[model samples]
Target: MSAPTAQRSVLPPRPSYAAVLRVPHARRAFTAALTARLSYGTVSLALLLSVTRATGSYAVSGTVLSLFGAASVLLMPVRASLIDRHGPRRALPPMATLYGALLCLLAALTWRPGAPAALLATAAALAGAFTPPMGPTMRALWSELVHDRALLQRAYSLDGVAEELLYVSGPALIGVLAGLAPPACGLLLSALLIVAGACAFVTSPVMPGPRPAQAPHKRSVRPSGIPGLLAPVAVAGGVGLALSGLDLLVMAFTAQHAYDTALVPWILGALSAGSAVGGLLNGALPWRMPARTRLCCFAAALGLVIATTALAPDLWTLTAAMTLAGAFIAPALTTAYLLADELAPTDARTRAGAWVNAAVNAGSSTGALLTGLLIGAVPLGICFLLSGGVAVGTALVAGPRRRRYADRS
Candidate 1:
């Protein structure tokens, strides 16, 4: 009898790490990153201005933001599913167009004071539902473009830093525009930028095509569900809660003291600035350390910094504490993303990433509400301490489990 033919390896040839870094696709990915930053900034600024102007209530603004977040969390998976089925090029443009149009309509509807809460809620929901899946789609495209895993890691680090910049500049620009012109003006401008950014990214030549159809045997090579996906999701959710608590603490302190509402902006700016610094450092740091160890250390540091915020004698001290807390944000977040990527089944990468996002938003919403309730019942310092403690505890619990799972897998 003839010997069986030798089986061929199915894996694609791995590219050199340096080649991936220098590729045109990496450059194009960076452009898309910039566009995402600008679009987020515009939308955030408009939201803050619109809610505040219409309701004259910070509580209303917070509620609206929370609702938008919840909506985004619920809808992200749907958008990711579309990308997995249709490719980034087909999925992005329509989502962006719908989102932008909704924002414009929202601005028009909220132009007058005393706009109906239902109308505002409907507009916010629509905007959230249609928001482009830029982050996930872009990451998927980056994986396809940069052939080296190391280069992909660097790309993610840079993207994280860009996100920090968006938070810093986006709201500040909206505030300035609203003050100079009107709230509606900022919303209109945001819509224009969203359309522009989405169009630029969708038309980019480097975007990946839809996955090809294959026989059942060929398709069986997809990634299987990792044994411990739950741990990372838990960690992400905990971190989200911590962030929400911090936000509430800042808001409550500012409101009670009647200091420049501008302090809120400055505090957020400090946090974003610190996060950007962390992202830059992430690329330079030695990657030999275990991901879990680094994440635990970062989370512990964040908790300590947050707890110290209670000791601040003035806004300056509080800002300093916040900056320190922010320094850990990117490191821990990067760890989570790396873990998620490692744990994801090949066919479910986008969905896995979206799940992480959803966990975060859900945690944040929970934390915000929890902190809000405690503001009247407890000392502000105590609230911060409790929130920080929760974060530290969560990291201790989840970090080790994540490592064990990855090691086994």
Candidate 2:
């Protein structure tokens, strides 16, 4: 071989997840972000238990949790835009502090048996309103910290896997703590986690510096809304809708088949386990396909798997199908994030990630609501098809149009 050709062949190997953490200050930043994000995982369960215990009314608890979730999910883009405008250092701390204080207030209100349901609901909503946007901020930081495209892909996969684990384990931790102490204690712990984590995270040298103050004479240019973002946002939302519906549908399936309801958790666990494994494998592969194309493929694959699950005659078959469907979840979301990063301007990166995050969450809420309504009135198999159909339809709508537009250009 020629010397130049030999030199190209000997170029350094691709970086691993370990290399992601080894980037200066990456570990500290990542750990702090995870610590704060865990609060999200724990807060819902803790709030549910606390409100239920205080009011002794399932109706009250459900309403309160609904309010909290709505406030948290709906406001993510607004909070993320604040981070984009002011930088994480300036924006995150204030949000975390207020969020923690509200959580603490909620803990106090729910500490005893008889706090008014109104007070509990108000505090919960306020706490959610102030919840910091840790995940988006961390993803944005990752883009800044790791410039190598291959290494960045690994970092995102590791981050997604770790986040999935955090959600799975966080509720379990809260469950144990609630068993040992008052459920209110779990709320307090969540408060502590967010405050400490956010404070530490913002102090990291890897964090972007504050946005320069704008002159009064000139208005800042806002992004022309969500044009380039339609594909990722729609795909992410579709995935969320399908996954969330799968949970309720599985429960309904068990009930209908007279199988043990206890098995639902195990089935769901399979889904999560498959996702974790798939995320790792996705990152490890050296893909020749464009990210947008890979994203559409992943979404389409998930939709097909989920749709096929409707035909499973037994719980075991359903579990296997769901596990297969889960394999595509992380890759789809990760690629959507990658595309969002590519499409967004630098100043709006945080908001772009937040839009995707918000879409997932909004779709999740809608899925659960709609799935709950359809389970009894509609056939179980039809319900599954509907859930899966959302994803397939989204992929079809978003995929070809972009390529056709490109061709015309």
Candidate 3:
């Protein structure tokens, strides 16, 4: 008898870039993006409206926001650790529910004409602590859905653009709502939206689960350990500090000149719009600069923009300068994420992402506090110039070390 024919194996045809994005899972990831944006948008509006109305002072608003930011920074690793252990679905729902409930409580408690500052601060801290790890989980899901690394990069770029749109439209929407109704109305609506968006995200078919072998560690309190995480963490923290300083400088300047505080939202909106535009351009451009170069360019450009704002002669010029300055925001943020991904171990990606987030929030808080203190003693423009100079100096010192770390990794 003739020898049995040897079995032959065939490889599946490779998918095209377009095909990957069109996959069902990838489509779900896109939907998740929209929901995530809506959720965060609502939270942002609530924070802005609640703090400003309760304290009747932008300084207090900044302080409350800074506190909320600190809460998020402190809790990010814990939330990420949960996701790393329990899978996104199991971990996210409880956190989201708690967060939504707390938001509602905060809104209800602060509805009075003059809520106590301590109470408001407590509410803000709770909201931050319980806010689900949507950003990182969504990103983790994106990694699972897309088969190609280039596609993953593109996906992240698109997500960054979406974030720009969220910040741009979200705060403006909040401001409009607050103008029309009471700030509490905005806060209430924010709670509802957060609940809706978060639930939708958790239920999405594309959300990934941790492998069965990687059981949720009941005792684990920190995110999975990863090498070289500190580098990205440091860079992110510095960038956050710079952005927070810039924010405070603008607010202080506006307040000192008695410019309509209404314009504050508009200035922030311009920055967001610029970031969105930058992300779009980055996506369309063929040149993919090394991550380090992108970081350096963005940091330098951001410093210049802040400095220019200090020199603007009128509101229009200031807004224009802010818009121009925003061009670097997305690039810098994107590079930070890329570095985090590079440094993170396979099992600790979510934790690594959280580290980056925490760094940014910490830096922002520090910068805001520093700038706020200086505003009382110096001219706003001088504070702006000083902040910008500090940002530039920090970036220059950190950029080289960051690049070296990236290379070693």
Q: Per-residue lDDT tens digits of candidate 2, residues 58-129?
A: 999999999998999888888988898889999999999999999999889888899898888888888879
- TM-scores for every predicted model: 0.81, 0.94, 0.79
A best-first ranking of the candidates according to their TM-score comes to 2, 1, 3
- Put down candidate 1 lDDT per residue, 1-409, tens digits, no spaces: 3333223345544434344457785666657656754766677658777888887877777667667767877888777767666777887789889988988987887677787777787788888888776766666666666545556666667666776677667877877787788787777887887788778887777876665433333232122244556666677777788887777788787877776776797797788788878766775565777766666777777877887788887787888888888888887776766666666544555655666667777887889889989998999989989888877887788767435354453
Off by over 4 Å in 2: 1-9, 212-226, 400-409
lDDT of each: 0.72, 0.88, 0.70
Worst 10 residues of 3 by lDDT: 1-10
User: After superposition, which runs of candidate 3 have C-alpha atoms over 4 Å from their true positions?
Assistant: 1-21, 47-67, 113-121, 179-182, 211-224, 251-267, 308-320, 379-382, 400-409
* Stretches > 4 Å off in candidate 1: 1-21, 51-65, 113-115, 212-227, 251-264, 311-317, 401-409
In angstroms, how far off is 6's CA in candidate 1?
Answer: 41
Candidate 3, residue 390: Cα displacement in angstroms equals 3.8
Best by TM-score: 2
lDDT comparing candidate 3 with the true structure: 0.70
